[model samples]
Target: IIGCSIAFNLAKLGAKNVVLLEKEKMTGMGSTAKCSGGIRQQFISPANILLSIESIKIFKNWQDEFPYPVQYALDFRQAGYLFLLHSKSQIENFQKQMALQKKLGVVTVGFVNTHEISTALPYLNISGIVAGVFCASDGVADPASCCAEYEKQAKMMGVQFLTDVKVSDIGANGTTRRKIEVVFTNKGSMLTPCVINAAGPHAAQIGKMLNIEIPIICHRHQTIATPPIKWMKKNDPFVIDYDDYAGQEFYFRPEAGNENTGYQLLLGGHEDGKIQIADPDKYKEKIDQDFILYLADRAMNRFKEGENIQILTKSGIAGLYESTPDALPILGKTEEVEGFILANGFSGHGFMHSPIIGKIIAEIALSGRSSFDITGLGLDNFKTNTRPPAEKAIV
Candidate 1:
């Protein structure tokens, strides 16, 4: 998703011969396809809020900016995102966080009282929910279609896409190490002055080609979908159980309304103790039996439903999170590598941050810097013994 956007922005900036290389047969058919399908701006971190705030601007006006032949919309429904709060401490935390979010230009994120949450989602059992943090601008969208449209617009602007391609090696020729000279792929070689590492889950291996070790690991995240049910309203904001926000609990939304899927509820569990995979290619794509049983039981209890509800995990799907040590993205040029810019390692927020990262990358490629400050998110944070504090606001 970010790669296609980068190509589009580069072309718009009057760059000649921008190209995209995808290892998969199609763009966004890998990890991005299985994304949570959310474009939310409700965040505790300043870096994440900045990225989503700018990204939402482009998404809100996507059709006008990137017109396509197909009659497809990004399906951005501003239904809102409701995080159920369990404790007074959580409410206080959200009160403080919402202030920061608003100060960072996120006007839609604020605290919604228990009565308001009940009014919006009357079907939910809000006995445990003390209060809620709701953001109307933060809701679900069709990530697959969004990726398709970006790729389409980029292609129209003369961006070349080579699918099923893999990078073998990369090196610089100039003795002073000014810029990237050539990139050797499995099929052939392409000589370019610059290269952006947007390799998704395979980004670490790609960085190894230039002998740069990016501290990113692929962790399998499992999600389950239920059969169509009328209980969940189409306009209800995506819900994150408070207990699960910092622990293993369900984070769910209305499954996208599509031909393949019916009126279903799709959900995922956050397993902090999950084992990280060395390679995404080798990880299993199906949910584990033990996890499936636990998920099914939790699903029924989560919605106060009976066993006959039959929200099964028989056909669960899994994806990889390109996670970093601090769970934040690495999004700038490294001091060691000259022309090889870093735009990967978004952890699990790749789709949400793609818009800002793409524009920033284009700015850096054309000029020398970006308009927005990205110094804290650069590679210097991961340099020798410089580990910063971790951000734990994830589900």
Candidate 2:
């Protein structure tokens, strides 16, 4: 999705000869397809918040940008995001985060006490929840559809796409110290002055071609979809049980609606405090039995209706998240290579941040810098040991 968005934004910026390559047989078969599709501005970092704000501008009014009669629809729903706070420390931390968000012009987000939460979502148990930070503007959308539209518009603007093509190596002109001259692929080689590495999980492998070490690791994230619940509403806000009581932190949101079967619910998040590093080529594509049991227990504890519904183990899907140490995407041009740019290590927010990342990458490629300040998102932060605090507001 980030690659397609970058191509689209490049074409939109009047750049000619833009080409997008995908390793998969079709686009969006990677993390974009497996994502939870939650878009939010309730982040601890300013860069992440700004990215969400800018991307939400397009997501909120996708039709204004894509127009109607198009093949793809985002299926966007602004049902909001509610982060349940349990501990006093959690409440205080969120209070600080809310203040930061308000300072950053995220005025629509506010704190909702337990009473308000219970009033709004009576289905919740609310046994230990003290408060919640709700952002009505932050919601869910169809990532696959959005990526498809981006590809379509980019193609309309003369951006070429090559699917099922694998990049083997990157070659630099011998005369220059660090300048990419050709991209070697399985099909053939293409001469290009610049290359943007948006290669999600395999980004680090791609960086090695130019001797640029990209610090990213792939973690397997599993999600389960429950059978249609009769009481489930189509407009329920995405709920996050942020407290880690008994080492269980879970979240749920109404899945795509169905008239015949009612509404299905997508449930995920039961951190076991172990990083399950995954090989991009080989990893379990199904949820673990233990995790499934954990989610079932979480569901029963959080909601009154959870006991009646059965958790479908077969309905689970898993994917990889390319995460960095700081939980922020590495963007902008690199000093090690003149024409090489970094758009990798989005953690798990790639789909949500695609729009703004595309624009920022285009700005850097066309000009020298972006209008939005990405000073803190550069790879240099790691080299200087000045990386910002890791994001704590992540689900």
Instruction: Show the colliding residue pairs in model 2.
Output: none
lDDT (Cα, tens digit) per residue for candidate 2, span 1-395: 99999898899889999999888898999888889999999999988898999999988777666523457868888899999988888888888988998899888899899999998988889998888989988889889999999999889989999999999999976555678899999999999999999999889999999888999999888899888887678888989899765465799999876766668899998576844899888988888887888788889989878788787778898898899988998988887788899999999899999988988999999997998888878887789876777776666
**Candidate 1 structure quality by residue, lDDT tens digits, 1-395:** 87887888787778888889987789997789778877777777788888888888877877766646645567887888888888888888788878988999888887888888878776666777788888888877787887887788888888899999877888775556556889888899998888998888888888888778988899888888777766776777888886743556667788745544435788777564664474777878887776777677666666755364565567587789898888888887877678888888888888988877888998988897999788678776776555445655666
Residue 39 shift from truth in candidate 1, angstroms: 1.8
Quality of model 2 by C-alpha lDDT: 0.87
Per-model TM-score versus the true fold: 0.93, 0.96
lDDT (Cα atoms) of all candidates against the true structure? 0.78, 0.87
Superposed on all Cα atoms, model 2 deviates from the true structure by an RMSD in Å of: 1.6
